[model samples]
Target: MTLRLGYGTNGLTDLRLDDALGLLADLGYDGVGLTLDHMHLDPLAPDLGARTRQVARRLAGLGLGVTVETGARYVLDPRRKHGPSLLDPDPDGRAARTALLVRAVEVAADLGAHAVHCFSGITPPDTAPDTAWQRLTGALAPVLEAADRAGVPLAVEPEPGHLLSALADFHHLRTLLGDPEPLGLTLDIGHCQCLEPASPADCVKEAGPWLRHVQIEDMRRGVHEHLPFGDGEIDFPPVLEALASTGYDGLTVVELPRHSHAGPELARTSLDFLRRAAATTNGAAPC
Candidate 1:
């Protein structure tokens, strides 16, 4: 079994998009986790189609794969990070969130990305759980259709403090989504370490069928902060081994969103650490 390694551009927010991709390719990474944000391939930018095509060419020339991501900190609302989410009380706000996701799907298709990762936002203080669930499902309707039409997967991640914060929450969403093949899971190994009842490896095993994308980082149990490998408590070898055992062919991306201050250094470090971890599992180098 093999796993391709990539790094998230959100972590490289300081670099130009081309420079970020070039740096990752030069580091021998197999792909990129491309985050759509105001500064990097903004989904709301005019001439987005042309920009996407250009990005596709650059990636092809670099011999790198990509996965689209929609977790930009303040893309939707400049003042509030991740505001106007799918569960927003106002119908227009929910519609806008859905539109952003649909645009993500369109970009994924254009870039030949394997998946588009997104999340359920925090539930509004005044909303009931059932109402939040309904709102989420309704908002996803068009996004799902766009994903299905584009032949790209919509991989919903379970964020630590968001509305859907666990593997079980993803399961519930799958049920609500009618288990569409294009609707899948973006399994963040660090998130499992932080909040899951099961070990990260076990979570990988259980999410095998639905897993479409992956994000990797290290974190202490019950702590939501993303940490560098040795600084955290996760036993990575077994977790990586479990992903390989499941025949997951997509990129297992390094997602250090807060490490952009030292982006280049951290990117190099992560690849080396992940390579050693993968070597422990298979006695061979990972891509």
Candidate 2:
């Protein structure tokens, strides 16, 4: 399977959507991890249908695949970053988050995206773990149904510091969902390095069957920083090899939102780095 390289809009936060798409296309990216944010797609914008159609047309013209990412802070709550999440104390807040994700599922369907990436939000203070899990699953249930109806996969990302923070958590989510077919994993390599006991490659290998999407970035061991290619301790070649071994054909998005100004260059460099690493690991090129 051909490994697809995509860039996340997080890294292009400063650029307008049109400019971001242009940069991604020019940089040889095959797709885009379109973060649903106010500055970018503006999911809360009126006339979402029209905007979705417009984006679909533009991406088609550019021959770029799309993946909806719903990790935008403050989209649902202006006062707090990622607040009123699935595990929020209030039921209305949980419903609001679910509604947003359902809209995202519709957008992904309209864009013909392979999947939409979501996450388990942080549990509030003094919340019981079981209660948090129940709340998160309850909130996600309708969203997953909407995704199934829209013919899009709902890929949950296991993030550091979030309710679901590792491969085991992901497995638990899948099991909780009764192993639903459309439910899958969006494995963020850097997060795995930061949170999982296994190496990123091992994590991917273990979660191979459920893996549907991927996010790649370098990060120091035990830290949550999203670093550039060589800045962190990750051994990316084996990670890529594991993905290849699993026959993962989904987009492997490069996410480094903190380096917006340097996004284009970083995207190009990261793609080149991954290609060279894959070649070396596959024995097609010398290290």
Residue runs of model 1 more than 4 Å from their true location after superposition: 283-285
The global C-alpha lDDT for each of the candidates, from Candidate 1 onward, is: 0.93, 0.88
List TM-score per model, in order: 0.98, 0.96
Error of 1 at 176 (Å): 1.7
Candidate 1: residue pairs that collide: none
Q: Supply candidate 2's per-residue lDDT for 8.
A: 95
Which 10-residue window of candidate 1 scores lowest in summed lDDT? 278-287
lDDT of 2 by residue, 149-248 (tens): 9989999999889999888898898888798878989999999888789999899888888888899999977899999999999998888888888887
Task: State in Å the error of residue 174, model 1.
Answer: 1.0
Residue-level lDDT tens digits of model 1 in 1-287: 76799999999999999999999999999999999997789899998999999999999999999999999988888987898899999999999999999999999999999999999999989889999999999999899999999999999999998889999999999998888878999999999999999999999999999999999999999999999888999999999889988888999899999999999999999999998888888622476
